[model samples]
Target: MGGLNSNAELRRLLEEIGWSPYELARAVNRLVSPDRRIHAKTPFAWRDRGTVPRDPLPAVVAGILTEARGEIVTVDQLWPGQAHKTEVWLPAVAQIAPDRWLPHDTLALLKEFRASGKAKTHFAVSGNELTSLAESWAFGNHALMSNRMTAGQGRITPDYIDYLEKDLAELRRLDDGHGGELVLRAVVNRLAEAIDLLSDSSYPADLGRRLLSLAGQMAQLAGWLGFDLGRHGFAQRMYLLGLRAAVAAGDKQLGALVLSCIAFQQTWRNRPHDAVSIMGTVQQGLRSATTPRVQALIAMREARAFATSGMHSETSAALERAHQALARGQHDHDPAWVYWMGPTVLTSEAGRCYLHLGDTLQAEQQLAEGLANLNQDATRDRVLYGLSLALAHARGTGGRQDLELACYEAGQVLPMLPEVGSARCRNLIDTINAELRPHRATSTVRTFIDKFETMKKAKIC
Candidate 1:
């Protein structure tokens, strides 16, 4: 062990998994090396010289073996004398199951994670893991053990619950105005506080329900911020957390909302089958509790999912249902959360679905209407739909007028990017820039690029 003895542990682990030394080396290289063609001599050297790979490669080796072996393969097992070494983050780090977590253990784990400052350091959920979490939320039968933990010892009041709600509303406003990057940490902090309050206080059952509902809302907001920041796995976990809180609070409507949020994220990830399935579950659950606006919102989301999955007939039907539901919705009867889910939002969503369906004409028409009627205060939505409209025009006939209009719409989105710190928003702009590449010779496109460059110099976008 002094110098570099043979890596007997790695050799044994590879042998146990029926993989040759070269295969193990190939897996590591494929995962770690961008070129993915590391020489087999590397593995030979490690086996003979007892050389540990680099900082993370040892962990990567363990992970590949774990997946293939269908069991937890510790780094120490893969490379002995490394028992004290931590497994650094890797591509599949999010997929690594936490030790001893059962269905009943989820709420406790979520609480413990929120209480731990270390958990805040990274966003560590993968899409597949997220889908699993979402499925559990939708169908799992585990119950929260109790709300009466000894660690929670405070006299909670209605005013305190109201204060939490107020905080949630304010944080949501910041999220809408400034994007997720600026407001996510604040929202997560508030969500943790809400969780604490739920457990720490004794109150009437109604008040307790309200507190739980507040926690659910906060969790949903946190999830939204997670998605906006491009932490899809984290977003999925947050959504499931919110769903659990909502279920515990006896708020079916809130639970449906959380499920719909997951569905939306699934659609974003191009897993339209999961998205559609999740939304169908949400719709079924919401039937008794939903307002027309809420129904419309869910229907539009379903339409988008269907469109993305190439289900043309289902997409058109869902869109029609959304429009019909919206027409029947009354502003006063809608929930506070659904207040923003108006005809304008429906138009924007319909436009999105059309774009996915490859109907640029319909996409442009609905997007234009949506933008025309969008509230001025919706900074993020404006930029998003603006970009979407620009994209629709770009994908259209590519006429001078179409291209110029696309550039104009894209340019209009620039000013707001200063206030919008969302990675998703930045990604949208990046996409628009890529879309306009072919039209670089056009003066309008050139002006758009110049303005964007100026904004970059000013650190606006």
Candidate 2:
């Protein structure tokens, strides 16, 4: 057991945490399903016999240790030399340089991302790092770079810019319908193309600014796709790069848009304070030229942050500002990215905020209105908002739970689940199933469980 195959690191970590092998196994089991549960003695084999646990166990164990220690732990640290197979890769934030947002840095990142293949290491930016980046963009007073003709053969024109913008819009539409997994590679490719043009092409100052803005837009979209796919570290890197591009273009509004995206990711990661801070940076940066729609979008994100942090009064005030901003109507100078930030999208987000705030009735009302008005082609949104509605119904008002209505609402989203490939949507479905498990005696809950299981197995098959 003390020979070449010994896992000294695993044993050391177990000792440091003061956890017995059985305790580690129990922790892993809690995070996984009953059928996938490991034996109580499994960690003994791992630590003493140097046996590496299969598939997700290593990652799960690492996560357990991370939570217990209040720090980041990785599978590689637990089982050295073992191939890591994790659902989501969370790399150390320090591994990514804080200032890697310049044009050459972005090119290198794109090259690395393209070459990394399927087993890419995802690096999450620390909250402090994100805040610093936001502050830099907001107050750095970044001036547009003077036009310099590069030696490469690519030539950019207004017609080309128009075509690129339309192509990006189309990519957004595809993502809305099919989710990130289906569209991520395409987005990366487009972002790479845009970067190449920015780095290799010779254009006038105006065209150069336009190209930079386009690159920022592409980076923002790619970042969002990465987030939707649960590659958060990769998402943050793209977001930082996008912010850099926006600054280079002297596009304060685009920079604010990128910051809002970062704030959204922070909210999802349960760092509401960081989200609120980033949103504040966005709001402060855009105080002069922000359009009504843009303001509404920013306020909605701020409201989400407040809701996540349990700031009821602040959340209400932010939502009111969002609604009031929308009431100002669309401005002629509104950015193209705010095209989707209308009543329907705002209502859905407000519903999400209320859901976080534990007001299930209000959540249900807002989500239902949003769903009813949602475009039929917005399959991913429907699944997300629909699942939120189901949760609200499951929780119900006062002391009552509407199991039947909950199942019905969830069932409505079941068929559309396969149409999109979002991990978030899948996670929400799992959450709903978990919530409904207690009422398994009820026929409605039983039927929903059966259908969900059948669909899950079918996907595997």
Candidate 3:
């Protein structure tokens, strides 16, 4: 009915594929709208485009034509073969759409584990599976990667981190619908396996480094899931394990990652003092971080801890340090493991710190910059970018418009929700709820509070 597609390539493609323009629109809409059932005439107004659908939709448009004609519609037929391949192939750094193309079964499994955020099932760590995974992780292809990615394994670490990152955002966005419902016995079992392998003295340094980081990563994820599920003891144990593993890897960057990371987890339990304590450790640990970017990481985390404590002075100091460190950038002497600790990362955490300090304006300023600079990797950075935006808006405006904006920012992060264990985010929402209760205007704020409550209740903790 609309002239949006008249005689255009899109319209021609629709005719070529035999799909009604209406049907194509429905599929696109359905993919984006998880809650909405697909229906024709769902409108694909140009004004409505969110993040551009990861590429290949044009090919899908071709495929639609192919499907319509009952013929194999090769993308190559539509575009030249090389051109077709180039068109559909995602950037190595792109977040979704190409998720299915990643080959590492273990990585995908980790992604699934994080996205699920369930840990209610009592984990049993025994038998062949445990020992096998440990052995492989501790002694497996890490050496091969040493030969392969020695040029930059730190670069790769960020990628693995990204896979988990997307899942964390998704977990947060879902609030608590299935927050603590998934079985994590398998993940725990695997971690135990990694622990076994890591403990062996025979492990090579490079392999040990990689395995330890993975172990730390696993522990970090497990702890969050545990928190979500309300298993505080278990969560704490896992965080401790993450700490130990990160240290063993001789990866100060990862240790910094965990130390500051645990600060977020501590904030969830209302342990702002403990959060501050952890941040102190992070600062001390940063002393040894030759990497300027790693120093930024430490500063950002410390700022977060300070903000959670409502210590505006300390928070400001930390935020300033974070920026200064980022300005210093990653020196050549910094370990490859710290490769992703760039300015964009600092901006994200700085935004978060400012938000918690009740400086919503400052928070928004940093957040906008952070989101603008964030690369399209799946790592925690992207999730945090969106999360910082949400928290900033939530605290800044606390109005219906702000709440809706926060929710939308939070939604882009649904796929990576679980890995983000920031008690700050949870507390921020609760704070927003308290602020909104007296207003009695937006049911949406109440709805948000209720949703997070379900998550809290549903979380195994």
Question: Top model by lDDT, which number?
Answer: 2
lDDT of 3 by residue, 9-110 (tens): 444455565667477766556333355333454324321321122244434434434323433344444443323342332211122121121223323333
Identify the runs in model 3 with alpha carbons over 4 angstroms from their true place: 1-190, 198-217, 224-231, 246-253, 285-289, 331-340, 375-434, 442-461
When sorted by TM-score, best at the front, the candidate numbers are: 2, 1, 3
lDDT of 2 at 29: 82
For candidate 3, what is the lDDT?
Answer: 0.52
What does candidate 3 score on TM? 0.48
Per-residue accuracy of model 2 over 299-404 as CA lDDT, tens digit each: 9999998999999999999999999999999899987777889999999999999999999989999999999999999999999999999999998769767889
- How well does candidate 1 score on lDDT at residue 151? 44
TM-score of 1: 0.76
Give TM-scores for every candidate, taking all chains together and pairing residue i with residue i.
Answer: 0.76, 0.82, 0.48
User: How does each model score on lDDT?
Assistant: 0.70, 0.80, 0.52
> Clashes in model 2: which pairs?
123-233
Better of 2 and 3 by lDDT: 2
**Off by more than 4 A, model 1:** 1-107, 117-136, 139-152, 285-288, 331-335, 397-401
